[model samples]
Target: MMRRGLLAEFPTGDALIAAVRALHQEGYSRFDAFTPYPLPAVQRLLGWRRSRINYIAAFFGLSFALGAYLLQWWTAARDYPVIVGSRPAYAAPAFVPITFEMCVLGTSLSVLAALFVIIGLPRLWHPVFAIPGFERATIDRFFLGVDESDPYLDRDRTTRALLDLGALRVSLLGEEAPPP
Candidate 1:
C-alpha cells in the first residue's frame, strides 16, 4: 500500500553503511538499506538480531523425521508385523534412510516457507519503487530508506540526519509520503 518514507542516496557502499549506522544510533529503527551487492558488514550495522529461521527449520525437520519413523515403527512392529528372512518386525535400522530423507525434506520445505514469510514475498510493489532514481540502487548506487511509520520520525529531522550522514541526495518518497 501507499505509505510515506524518506530515501537517501549514498555515493558509495561504505557511505550507505555508515549512514545506516548513524541513523540507527540516532534511534530511527524503521529503515532499510539497498545496495548493488551484498555487504556483510552492513547487515551487522543495521541492528538486525540473529535470525531464528534456522531454529524453526530444525524443529520442523526433527518433528517430521520423528513422525515418519514412528509411523513406520507402528506399521511394521505393531499393526502388521511382516517377518521376512528371520529379520525382526520392527527393523529400526531399515527406517534410518527414510527418516533421514524425511528430515531433509522437512527442513528444506520449512526453510523455504519461512523465508517467504520473513521476506514478505509475493509483494509486487513497494514504496521504495516509487522513489526517483531508486533503480540505480540495483546498478551502481546505494540507498538507505527511513520509513515515515517510525514513531520518532520527523521529516525535517530525518532529512537533516541523512544529509549529515553524507547522503548525496535525500527526498521524500512520493507514493508512501503522508498527506500534507
Candidate 2:
C-alpha cells in the first residue's frame, strides 16, 4: 500500500507545539497535531481558519424560510384560496410563525449536517489509531503527524527534523506495520 504519513511522538505539549511551528516555518502545511489537552498555540501554528458553518446555516435557513413563505402564500392565494375572516389570501402576517419556525429548523439542521460532514462523523477508524502508543495522545503524550503528500516531505529528512525537534520516536504510518 502507499505510505499514509509519518507519526512523531513528543514528550511534552511544548515540544509538539515547537515541532509544529518549525514544520510550519519549513513550509509543511499538511500536518496535524494531537495532544492530551487543547493547545491554542498549536492550533494557531496550524493556521486553521474560522469554520464556514455559519454561512451554511444562514443559506439553508433563509432558503427554507423563503420556500415556506412562498408555499404558504401559494396555498392561500393560488393553490387553495381560502377566504377566512375577510383576510387577504396572501397575508404575510399569517405566514410569519411558520416561516420563522422553518428558518429555525433549517438553521439547526444545516448546522448539524455541516458539522458532521466537515468532521467526517461516524468514522469507526483512522490510520492514526493504528499507530502503537498513539492511544497516549488522549492521556499525556503529544503527537505530530506529517502527511506523505506534503510537498516538503522526504522521509529521512522529516524523521531527522522531527528527532531534532525532540521527538521521542518517528514511525512510518500506512496500511502495514512500520519497518523495524
Best by lDDT: 2
Q: Spell out the clash pairs found in candidate 2.
A: none
Q: On a 0 to 1 TM-score scale, where does candidate 1 land against the true structure?
A: 0.72
**Which regions of candidate 1 fall more than 4 Å away from where they truly are?**
1-3, 24-29, 36-41, 83-87, 132-140, 149-168, 174-180
Tell me the whole-model lDDT of each prediction, alpha carbons only: 0.84, 0.88
In the range 65-108, model 2's lDDT, one tens digit per residue, is 99999999898988999888999887889999999999999999
Count: clashes, candidate 2: 0
Q: For model 1, name the residue pairs that clash.
A: 3-176, 4-176, 4-177
- Candidate 1 C-alpha lDDT tens digits along 42-136: 77776667889989899999999999999889988899998867899988899899999999999999999999988889887766776778899
Q: How well does each candidate superpose onto the true structure, as a TM-score?
A: 0.72, 0.63
Off by over 4 Å in 2: 1-3, 10-14, 26-29, 35-44, 47-53, 76-94, 112-124, 133-141, 151-157, 163-169, 175-180
lDDT of 1 at 139: 98
